[model samples]
Target chain A: MPVLYASLLTLFLILIPGIGIGLFNMKALFGIVVLYGAFLIFISGVIYRVIIWAKSPVPFSIPTVCGQAKSLPWIRQNKIESPHTSWGVIKRMLLEVLFFRSLLRNEKGRLKTGGRLLFYRNLLLWFGGVLFHWSLFIIIIRHLRLFLEPVPSFVEFIYGLDGLFELFTPPLLITDLLILLGIIYLFFRRLFDPQTRYISISTDYFPLMLIFAIVITGLLIRHVQKVDIMGIKAFLIGLFSFNPSLPKESNTIFYIHLFLVATLLSYLPFSKLIHMAGVFFSPTRNLKNSSRMERHINPWDYPVLVHTYEEWEDEFRAAMKDVGLPVEKEN
Target chain B: MVYDKGKVITGLVVFLIILLSPLWYNALSGKVEPSLKLSMPKEEKSCIEERMFMRSNHMDLLIKWRDDAVRKGIRTYKGLDGKVYRISLTGTCLSCHIDKAGFCDRCHGYSGVKTPKCWDCHNIPKEEGSKV
Candidate 1:
């Protein structure tokens, strides 16, 4: 049911701009309105989510400690795993973001035919994550060519390097190949893995299906169903300039690819994908493990009214005398 | 209610800087013109294929021509207009395109595409092609 819904929804999204441009010729609506609206939503939505996360006060220095913390001089501290200082936290965050250290280090449990429990590190998921993220980073950076006028030297250098193989007529870029492989691996992993599939909901497949269509449409425009490169650039430039114009030589496939991209951006902030921003705000990942060395007081802690022993004794002196009991004060 | 106010500001500043880098870079340069125009052939009234087809699918056509000529030992191409043209890049494409810099390099440079390996095999022509 999840698979059917995701695939059907993706097909419907493609047909939207496809039919809009192909039949109705509403280029301006998709080209200008949808694209810019998505951008506005994406930027503001991400910022809002980040700010909302920042508003919540962290009440503890409870960082997840996997190794020896900073203590006695003779005892060595595993700084990266149980960070005590801000600098150590930074290093740990870098390792987590760049390398997916947690995923790589995490162990998976399996049950054998003989009812034996086995524990092992699953590298395929880690490898797939790394592949997908790095490829995405490269692809996004390369796309600066369309957004920036007189493309920067670094962009040009990377572009040349990525297309070094220069195999096909348009050149089969390595990142493109890697990204496709990564996405396919991710989709099948989710489908085949028992634990993952059991926990998976419909929304998980939505992004995968949408991105798959987007990538396929992008490949089609570049290699198979070609579009006018010149006109497309002009249209993009106009969008950035806040003066939108529909190109006369536009292709339906290009519009479909673009619509999918816009949809992804718009959906990012509201979905689980907001973790891109939330990662930085994570208490476990970002907090310092200095609970013993420093007091971890709650920010909302406030003072309360109190009664002194002397005041209580003075008030009860008369009552004590009547009852013939000893008192600290004389009447 | 917020914790780490300084860190939050710094994070947001950094995020905005990277996200808006393209806009700022382009705005500072004050150059908005899309400079990917190709110089058309002067004497040739029509290409082997239509102009629109040539604009987008030229690379595929060129590759097919190269394979057909070199690997299959086929040297003739049947144009959509039913004209037979020799499958030679230097003798045919450059005869009209003339200036490689103006006709080819401009688009490639603007798009940040690597200079194709076509020149490794084909002979270099004089700049008079642009003058033509």
Candidate 2:
């Protein structure tokens, strides 16, 4: 089932761009409309999934506790892991969201002396994960130049900072390289690691592969194919303005890049990637662990007629007497 | 114990508020700018005057084309000397025109093209005497 789901997702992800490119390359109005319709479906699906997950039954308080649970006053607690207070939870959530701290804590199994197996703290996965995510975020922010009017100064600053490590011709974007490298490392490790591969379904590999394809296609368009950036911007602006005019000389490579982006957008909500939104709605991350501190009566529980212990005992006294059962009043 | 209607009501109300407040704000804050009158060059003035006749979409298109010219780094924007102008046709027009039909399906709206992703960079209804 996991393999099927992942395969279907990967197929959709890959085909969406293929279809978008086919349509966009044709420059047909119907094609563009279809693209928009596809986008609508994608957006709707994402929201639906999020809402359903948000409404899912979290019947128990099963937070992955790693900290001291606000117990004895003198006990020292791991504030950042097993958070007991709202502030602590927030701190924990920040680390989880920004750093993937839990994943960072993952230990790699190592074979030691005399064939004794041991687990050692692995920082590479954590570093790769963080590098990929932050770099991807920076790249996205930098690209906001193409989308926003007056392009926020922060975006420009980031763009400049990203270009700081450029040592080659045309000024290489370091974040781009980092993200590419990170994706590559992650992909190979997933494939090469024996334990990971043993448990890994095709679904796990699909997203990584899809991302790799996207990065490659993007790089090709930027560096090799050399699509006219201005023309592309014009196209985007034109798309944003409700006037879709193609320049007489349009580059096919630009269409490929756009197709991939559009595909990613439409696919985002349906896939594991929707975790972006899921992270916010997560009861674990968002909800305060105030169960012990404050009463959390189930909001869904219905009101019912109360029967006190005394009343119950009185009702059951005759039956208890017949059964020779002891009671407060020995009938 | 069964369901609590009061709690459900509270949750629903909170959910509605969270979802609708931003949408309400978005709708309330949107202000469509007034369309501009086209100030044409002397040779093309009469021709454009007959065509536009106070219609703003035409002016909007003209401004779009001019901005497109500037964005292409075209030297066509007058009074800039010894500057490199990269004159080119671009997809800016298509971005907004393509999205118009679905976006403006109401009010008997009619546009020659469909795009909605354009207004990000250039000002719509381009102002007269503004630098390209």
**iRMS values in order, in angstroms?**
1.8, 13.2
Model 1 quality (TM-score): 0.92
Please, what are the lDDT tens digits per residue for candidate 1 over residues A1-331?
7888889999899999989999998988888899889988998999899889989887777688799999999999998899998899999999998899999776789899899999998899999988888998898898888777777889988887888888887887788889889989999888999888988877888888887888888889888889877677767877887777776666889889999999999999999888888889899999889988888888877886777877887888888789998877686
Q: Candidate 2 — which residues are off by over 4 angstroms?
A: A1-25, A29-31, A111-115, A166-169, A247-249, A303-312, A316-326, B1-132
lDDT of 2 by residue, A204-227 (tens): 777776676677766765555554
lDDT of 1 at A179: 88
The alpha-carbon root-mean-square deviation between model 2 and the true structure, to one decimal in Å, is 11.5
Q: How many residue pairs clash in each candidate?
A: 0, 49
| Native contact fraction per model | 0.61, 0.00
RMSD of each: 2.8, 11.5
DockQ of 1: 0.61
lDDT (Cα, tens digit) per residue for candidate 2, span B5-81: 35444644564554343234324544221221222333322322223221323333444456666666443422124
**Which candidate should be chosen as best, given TM-score against the real structure?**
1
